[model samples]
Target: MAGRTEGADLKSVSPNQPGKDYSRYFQPPSLKEAKKRGKADVQVHYDFAIPEEMAGIGRGKHFLIRTYGCQMNEHDSETMAGILREMGFAQTDDEREADIILFNTCAIRENAEDKVFGELGHMKSLKRDNPHLILGVCGCMSQEEAVVNKILAKYQHVDLIFGTHNIHRLPVLLRDAMYSKEMVVEVWSKEGDIIENMPKLREGSIKAWVNIMYGCDKFCTYCIVPYTRGKERSRRPQDVIAEVRELARLGYKEITLLGQNVNAYGKDLEGGSYGFGDLLDEIRKIDIPRVRFTTSHPRDFDDRLIEVLAKGGNLVEHIHLPVQSGSTEILKKMARKYTREQYLELVRKIKAAIPHVVLSTDIIVGFPGETEEQFQETLSLVEEVGYDSAYTFIYSPREGTPAAAMEDNVPLEVKKERLQRLMDLQNRISLEKNLALQGQVLEVLVEGESKTNPDVLSGRTRTNKLVHFVGDKSLIGKFVEVRVTEAKTWTLRGEIAAKVEV
Candidate 1:
């Protein structure tokens, strides 16, 4: 339901005072050493144990969670769901029908925060009708000092607040909020500590999210991920592999290795025995039918990793390599170390090795001091790459990031125009790409029914292209061959080629 909206402009809601930029503290390690020494020392803390008496407090209650933001937050919601269910809480879809409601939020952009605030306001009437109803907020938004202060001062109805680091303590936090009759606020504002063996309730039966690593060390000047997600920490390789093996045992067909920068996995551990490539090789050996990982940094993407992806049969062919800018000048201002030539070369190498691989990318239309030429360079790059899809946006300055302090020279109207142009180009390319698949059969992993039309089932191709076809509900979670009948800019219309043997 959180699909891209049309002609959305990034607006600044909250502004901060001028100060020495803290963005340098979260800078990505040098390219030469990132694969070797980029990993930070992780101090695992398991001391915040939940009390036994409060374990079954939710025995007669039902709760529901609405997650916003990136995949990382969704995975966190899954963990929270698992925790609540463990304490005897039943899941509900309608917030009014439930005794508790949790909003797992995102603070990447100001609009995200605005949406969360609006939802909280809407839930206020619900709280009035059912005074016993518990309302809570968590995730990256809670990590912000400004967000916490505003919530404490104005949104007195908010029952509980936690941050990215303290999710493992949610059970206890909820219990305290309920009993104390006081607002509960606990957020750690520092590089975080890792907590392992946390509960998780996955949303899908065939697909599972396995966090191979946590946090981001790359502090892009316009981004807030490094601050919200703590310092980077890779999970032990054996632990990750073991988790995947269990998922395979549970009959899961797909596994998405999650992280702030997934490709940087294992750089923080000692002895340098394993890296992301090593983990990919290990996971490929497992019996999971599909393996994918997000958000590889172009600065850390190397030859060895590309080779591994090419070699690994289980690793999917779609790669979401984000090249936020095209001009070297703009990239440097953005603190994206790689140049446009270097990014293109990497793309060339990837395509050379894996000829059928479809490529996707992230692009920001306007930065602090972007010029028309630089914007044109981005347009040229988009044309050159012929991307299968793109996530394009007009830049919004996040408070505390270095770019926020710089003069935003690009006019709002210009930013919107550039974003529209970029989207138009991408849509044309996407349609052309999808057209090539017409009359061809693609292996699609059936996810569920299409939201727009339930009579049609939907899934995705290995290239991560969405496809919709008329099929029985029994086909859900199974891989089926769909012959493309029509091609749209965003999705494919298809028909079942044959009945799946399974």
Candidate 2:
């Protein structure tokens, strides 16, 4: 909304000040130390205010964000983009064409971190060529001490680096970086307070990602989320409901309530006075066409939550409950706080309540001491649940988590083999599940043309299944009924059954 067009002027002026000496901020973090920090209670609720004066400093400039991570990171990039846009920095799709480039990174997987660094390496020439190209990195990866150290030691060209907790301070950080010659590093170590009322440039026209909460309390040994993201803190109920209502009024059809552990919402404030189920009940009243939530922990999921799903309205019939492992022993090792039997029981209860519900899960194939029998237990669980789909992975130890210290004695070849076997079994199950939907009408929120074929429109079922069907491009953003004509392992093919008016 600036009068003067941004991204038109570059090579104006440059002021490089060596960033302030914050060496301690880059020191490697220990899992034990991180655990203690998590235990040390601090304020979870506070008002967040961004620096207003620097809002227009980026007028006549452009910035590009290369986000690497999951949906949370993608959403974080949206917030960052909105912040940059507010500062009059137009977003440039081309990295080399931008005045400033920011990377919103993830630390969940070591490979993800490596990929980020690889990109940084690739962008070194860009920074060298464009001295004014303010390179910034933030998000879960920036929260890691090792990652920070690596960046400071080698990637000195990065102008700014901040963490997940301090996104509200981006404009201030950018101002500091713009004036300074050194890298601006400000990563918070504590469970930072909640930030509400941040502007976001969402990706989809019909669907949006709403962060109902931040961080995770579940210290699954294999996961670095608890350490990187801090603890579970839910957004205020009214704030969440307001977002849903606004999205509905804006004609958005679907809203996914995102959180590291969504089922644990509201446990932080008022000693759990109101829970996630109640929150969903209120959101349902907002009357969005479809509502869904992810990454629910079995330990936090209760009978009440299941009951709400049973009496569904706008809430979708799909749940992405991450059962990290199917083996009870592995579950204990991961500190998931729920046994396999308990998880199965929860699934059973869910199915009883919502009989038509489709389930998807996360599974880790290899662990420190997983034996053949234990691996079999995982396979058995897959068969028992008959999951619609699963995001299966071979365990990859993250440096600062408890699992990293564990002896990775599982042979690499064996781990790969186990992973393949698991996928092979799951593929059959997925194909079988999809085949069962043949000729059945599924309500799909038409997203857009399919990636492979433009003549065919693509969308997702309420159960979160991807379906591609032949239709006009104008069908995008509207819900339509598609009868499954062909079922593949991963996607469904169909012709347009009819249009649905919500």
C-alpha RMSD values across all candidates: 7.4, 5.7
Cα shift from native, residue 427, model 2 (Å): 0.2
Give the 10-residue window scoring lowest on summed lDDT in candidate 1: 1-10
User: Of the candidates shown, which would achieve the greatest TM-score relative to the real structure?
Assistant: 2
lDDT of 1 at 461: 82
Off by over 4 Å in 2: 1-23, 26-28, 37-52
lDDT of 2 by residue, 51-151 (tens): 77886888889988888878888888999988788788888898878998888998878788889999899889998899989998888888787787677
Cα displacement (angstroms), candidate 1, residue 80, comes to 0.4
Model 1: colliding residue pairs: 39-267, 39-268
lDDT of 1 by residue, 1-502 (tens): 0001123331211113234232221222122222232234677654644568767888889999999998899999999998888787888998877887999999899999999999988988899998888899989888776676666656768887777877887887787767756666666544456777777888979889998888887878888887777678888887788889999999998889999898788878887657898889888989888899998899888777888999858899999999998899999998888899999999999999898988999999889899999999999998998899999988987776788889998999999999998898899999999999999999899999999998999998888989999999999999999999999999999999975443
